[model samples]
Target: MTEISRRALVQRLVASTAFVSGASPLSAAPAPNRSPPPPAPPGKFEFDDVVRRARDLAAAPFEPVAPPLPDALNKLDFDAWRDLRFRPDKAFPIGDSFQLQLFHLGHLYRRPVTINTIRDGIPTPIPYSANLFDYGRTKLDKPLPVNLGFAGFRLHYPLNAPKVFDEVIAFLGASYFRVLGRDQRYGMSARALAVNAGTEAEEFPFFREFWIETPESGADRATVYALLDGDSTTGAFRFDIYPGVDTAIEASVTLFPRKPGVKFGLAPLTSMFFIGENDHRFSSDFRPELHDSDGLLMHSGTGEWIWRPLRNPPKPEVSSFLDKDIRGFGLLQRDRDFDHYQDLDLAYEMRPSYFVEPRENWGEGRVDLVELPTGHETSDNIVATFQPKDSPEPNKPFNYGYRLIASLNPAKLSPNGRTLNTYQTTAAALGSPEPINPGSRRFIIDFVGDDLRYYFSDPQLVEVVPSTSQGKIVRSFIVPNPHTKGFRAAIDVQLEPGQSTDLRAFLRSGSRALTETWTFPWRAS
Candidate 1:
């Protein structure tokens, strides 16, 4: 399958995004003599100062920066955007371990964020220079505006090897940013804030300004602060990143809602789930699987671990898992076998899964999961976020925070064993001696962990607890799967035609839970 470029995908999404309440600078005519923004908030800038700025911005009407970029630069396409590359020596000098690289403005990215470098608690603006970038083939016969700023910036550090800087994280496009580990490529994205996602009138917030601090020499972490603005809300966000085999970003957010009763989704994750092991809609394709993530994994507040396999349903499906004090949740790419995808160019196996761990006490909320149908793998159709039970009223203060970790093996993310594989078949001929319930479907869920191995020595010691929301569980049994060297829970259930059931299963022996509960919504075919 021919996939679209990431820039093209983001640009398309930006077009669909709803950012109102404020006049956008994109459609505004450019002023010939564009000058730099009238200086930012004065004095030594700190975390609380950023929060104060967000509050102050929320009190007034939004004013966008006027652009002076030539129409020629504004009309470039994806190929032309790719041609404009930042030269190496132009990397921002932050520290010995990390350097910053900026993204050039293009048709896809119109809004230019004010980029500043913070040192000794003071801010200094980074001037826009045409000398910093090389315009490969897009011949710009006219001189561009000297005040034209950048779209966004990416962090480059020696994540893979010593003395070699590799891009570990990037902040670009409408409140969207992506992270990568040592050997992983960018597949999924996490947004700063989501407003009315999965609804008719969804809003996309924008990061209009950024303050990247110079990291201490030889330190392992770097801190970046941002000022966010949108039609519905304004906020301040601080991100602290530690890059390695598994990159972890500690994010602190404070939201100021302009209008009351606006739904807010904190730490939202967006990914692609075109097809996977459970779905055969794309069985005729060259690759067996096409997805950035195949399941949603969560560690609830009550210490119950749940794994919900992803699907491109016939219609838009949204599920909410209520929690009192949510621990963590994330969209996971569980299957890691190269043979599963068989694509040499896009190594689906190397895609990183992001987990959001709550830092403060989230009193009560529901982790919302949204799955939108898609025909191709290029479009991201899956979105998940934490919806608080009670939102702060308009003109009130709302603050939340989470730690985001980008990794491949979520098995190490929590203490409980995880679901290794899951499949549902129409026929129930395997593992059953006699013809059991008529029209009953079969399910095989494999789990592997330390707790399971302790009980797998004696298969009878394990029990499969299966339950359905509105169906009859004909039978349930547990057996040791030699393939995974773990316990496999086999279940049979019968549901009438046109009926849908929410099924859940977990392995246990006596009072001990062996694996996380595997849950799925099934519709009888």
Candidate 2:
């Protein structure tokens, strides 16, 4: 298999049956004489209990400690780890709708997390045992500790087909979690919190424990609770996940700061963008475009929408859009055509775009989008978050909530014209001479929306308005593209050597705005 296909099979867990719970096929019989496990001590449980624990943890000096795992297990390679599968019969079966599977501790994922099943408001912890897994290889004949714990877990449900028991969502590797809608494959991921992100001393607070509530028969939803701990912040998170057309997760978080908040990101969405329509200086591949996400879309509080195309620049880049009472923002994979990405495996078109809708006004914050340089498609190079202007004092209370919708289309989030795609060519292509100034570049930004109506009949009436912050607008115009049925806004700009420019454009006619704002940052190579 190709590298990406192998990675998708491994990372996406498409063939995770061995990982789910059995050294053999899921239909294989369990060890004879093994009976169902009895739930641990049950006690009154509620989301507030997690909040109390986090609050208490923040009151004391932060403890950055984790129990060490067995050296043999720690030294296992990826292939060896993949061979160790959880026995499916050992999963905590919640009717026919949900099944829970645990991840084994290994080299990369060393930190152990607590897992529990909530019954009637009481939580019963699930202990670890070597018999629960099938050790296919590596000569692991020695027995492991009873409290060996687990790395993370995955939830299974019949999303696409009945009796298929497709994996729906997973909480694994730090505070990361991802969900797959009906036909969408895994792409971008979401996090609980980001402390001092993008700075020299940035900290990644992890979810130390998870509490998964029991699912009812034939239920289409489940809830999970998490406790986040780190050097800078301790927080409690509750996620109510509903799987459907656009798998939506309603998130409620409460954070307690251990130190004064310097900088942080809320509802951060992380993705990869190795190469796309905007930048292609580094690509030598067969596919026309390759990325988990292509652009960042935002809906401002003032009822304005904006689209910023993503890029893999020579150096790391970050941009912020300041606003009060922010509405929503996310990294989106808008291009769904398979022709755009011709790879038969790792279907990029099946990736879903996540749009986070704030349940209430998130007062005084800037949507920060950070793009880092990456060499391959495997590494995530993009992060977008809502950075609140004012952070809560140390040891004080802070709370926020939002709804994350995993969909291909972010409808109703913005009603204005949408940016279809962005491409760049030399200024000479736009009627300039060869070797036309080294500082000159032309851009073709296609925007389509309700505003494009009637513009075809009176094409010359509509205009493309463009402006730059640190350069001269060499030329600008708007023309109709019969192929896209949308107006293409073309602009040429001249920049000095080593100069960077912020360009903005939108469709307009007679003192009225015709399209949502399109923003791009350009640096002369």
Candidate 3:
């Protein structure tokens, strides 16, 4: 839980940017001398310049650059902090395709980030001004300091409608950002990197500055460059964002470690899984399920696809899948039925899933999934990332490239059959002569896909392959699911009292597998 706070606390609700005008009284205007760096000369500004800064910074002791925020802003609550919004008229436009909206420094976001817009090879730093924002209902007795910088920024484009600008992507907090495609609500978020994520000694790297290239008229994409700094490392990143029905961001990252043997996770994702189809801890609630994502989807270099159902464990849990030349992976929301959630305000079904596609061969690494026990829906309890076997050397450059896709149709990324839903209950049935076995449980998994539908008529040929790491599989069988035009695999497991079990199962026809292997971690009550 302490580590969660180190990396800026995850926000479940989208940060509002609504603009209105109001003012208040403050005692004194406490201004810091902090200001953004001077603009680079035309033709001199480049990605290499960011790399040089990172390299130079990594060579020195990490001096965190967080100046104290004014008391007027420091004392404000969430509602009052959100009331301060960037004026729409102050938004920086990029050609005719996209615009950038700034975030004010207050509340949970006390760290400031420098923002610059590059046009025709010249970089222009955006200065902070009270005129840029509409302070709604906030009473500042004294005027705000001129040196107060921005917290972060969000990018907007006409994604859903041709004329109306919708938020496409946002970069805020500590190297944290979320993207949205058409009709998708903010849910899970992607991070530039995670340092010592699954360990007790976790570190959060912050993106301290950004340089965005102004797009040309009629261009469909935008380029953004960023500088990240932390206690262990410094980095330079380039993100090329494309907005569409399935928005994508191609990320090129270069890291320079300040110390040797530091654990680094590339392309990490953060999400919430308070409850789901397989978890009944809070079934008394009106909603059938509540979660931003249902499962962890992975495609190994061996071409085997794996699905692990998310859980809210009794304690912190970390699972790693060993692999070589990793292909792809992501935290996905497979259940999209509105009836499954039934929440009108949140619209959980419309939350987009993020898929990480590696642009190069990242050889010999493990995909790590960390799930922390949580009682509230606001906390992001699930984190997934890829950790390389070899640690980056001190003062050496480490580079990786990947494509992050935010979409409503993550199912299309998988070629094999996928698990539609998972359920668990006591193995005993009423009226049976057999005594109730408290240690026994039954797991029901339904899988659906294009290939599975073809073998629905010949259910006899399909087989359910089940395995348990610490339990006996009493019985395993497959039955046709007429409703989904797929097959349901049921397994009765007898577990040892007070022991936990790791279960894996998949559907197969003859010698060929029809679906991705479904994995789950079950703990005794």
Say which prediction, candidate 2 or candidate 3, comes out ahead on TM-score: 3
State the lDDT of candidate 3 residue by residue for 347-407, as single tens digits: 9999999988887888887888888777878788888899998999988999988888888
Model 1 steric clash pairs: none
Best by lDDT: 3
lDDT of 1 by residue, 60-178 (tens): 88655435456886788889988999998989878778899999887678777889999866888888888899989978887766568788999999999998999999998878899
lDDT of each: 0.79, 0.78, 0.82
Global local distance difference test of model 2: 0.78
Q: Return the lDDT, model 1, position 286.
A: 89
Per-residue lDDT tens digits of candidate 2, residues 1-525?
111112222222211121111111001111123232233334657778999999998888876767888878878888998888888888788546788999888857778899988877677889998877887975675778988889889988778887687778988777888888788899888877777666655667788889988756666678788999988889999887887767778888999988885577899888888888777788789898889998888877776777889988666666778877767788889888899899899999889898887878888878877777677888787788888888778878789888888887654445777788998988766454667888888988998777686687788888888888777999898889888788988999999998878788899878878888888888787
Q: List the residue pairs that clash in candidate 2.
A: 21-86, 21-87, 21-88, 22-86, 22-87
Pick out the ten consecutive residues of candidate 1 with the lowest summed lDDT.
20-29
